[model samples]
Target: RGLFPSFFREAQRREVLLEDLLYVSSAFERIAEATEEMLAEMEDSLRKPVDPEEFRHFWLALAEDLEREL
Candidate 1:
């Protein structure tokens, strides 16, 4: 996951001990799972036709919130 790569690099750059880094890296799995679920939901939504303007707004808001969450 992008978060892991960036976080791992940051921890290493700061000379964090491997044990500490390992603990921090443990959170990556949950983050990755959440990301995958969100993507899959978006893909499923795209499989069906929806009102263009409404769907656009829905996806745009979702994207904005996800970006903030990430």
Candidate 2:
């Protein structure tokens, strides 16, 4: 990935171990899994929803994830 070189550079500077790098990779995988699940559950109907609570919960989860990214 475009970011891989930069990540490796920083990892080298920090002397991060191969084991720690594996853990970091796992973190990215978890994020991917969560994102896929959220989309599966909500994105197909992201435009709008009939139920008030479903609308609220979906937007809240999306907003939380956005904030976490920032």
Candidate 3:
């Protein structure tokens, strides 16, 4: 069984090629990288002393950036 059996079956019926799968795999990698970077920034912020309002703004901005990426 595959992760998305129906979708995979449809894709196979459509004769989807390896390159198409690779392209989607790469896109997912990019999204994962962005998420990791955002989490690292948040972790660093927590390690340091920051003003409450400033931290809130920083967190919100990071969240927005992540939303845009996804």
Candidate 4:
């Protein structure tokens, strides 16, 4: 299976250029929202401030998820 799933089939007609890009953009937004939620959960569990190293892991995961979703 493709890592980034196509949102539409080839048989479907495109009425306007860049219309499909909107769908992909929305999917990316969802991916970002999920990442933010996961990070928030981690933040909630921590008594001390989140360290730079820990934040880097969270950011890398977000980027990876966005790449896959896109």
**Model 4: ten consecutive residues of lowest lDDT:** 3-12
Which candidate wins on TM-score? 3
Q: lDDT for every model?
A: 0.88, 0.88, 0.90, 0.80
TM-score of decoy 3: 0.48
Model 3 per-residue lDDT tens digits across residues 1-70: 5669988888886666677788899999999999999999999977997799988999999999999999
lDDT of 3 at 21: 82
TM-score for candidate 2, residues paired by index: 0.41
Model 2: CA > 4 A from native: 1-16, 44-70
Supply every candidate's count of residue pairs whose N, Cα or C atoms clash at under 3 angstroms: 0, 0, 0, 0
lDDT of 4 at 9: 40
lDDT of 1 at 43: 97
Every model's TM-score: 0.41, 0.41, 0.48, 0.42
Best by lDDT: 3
lDDT: which is higher, 1 or 3?
A: 3
RMSD of 3: 14.6
Pick the winner on TM-score between candidates 1 and 3.
3
lDDT of 2 by residue, 45-65 (tens): 766557988779999999999
Residue 54 lDDT (model 2):
79
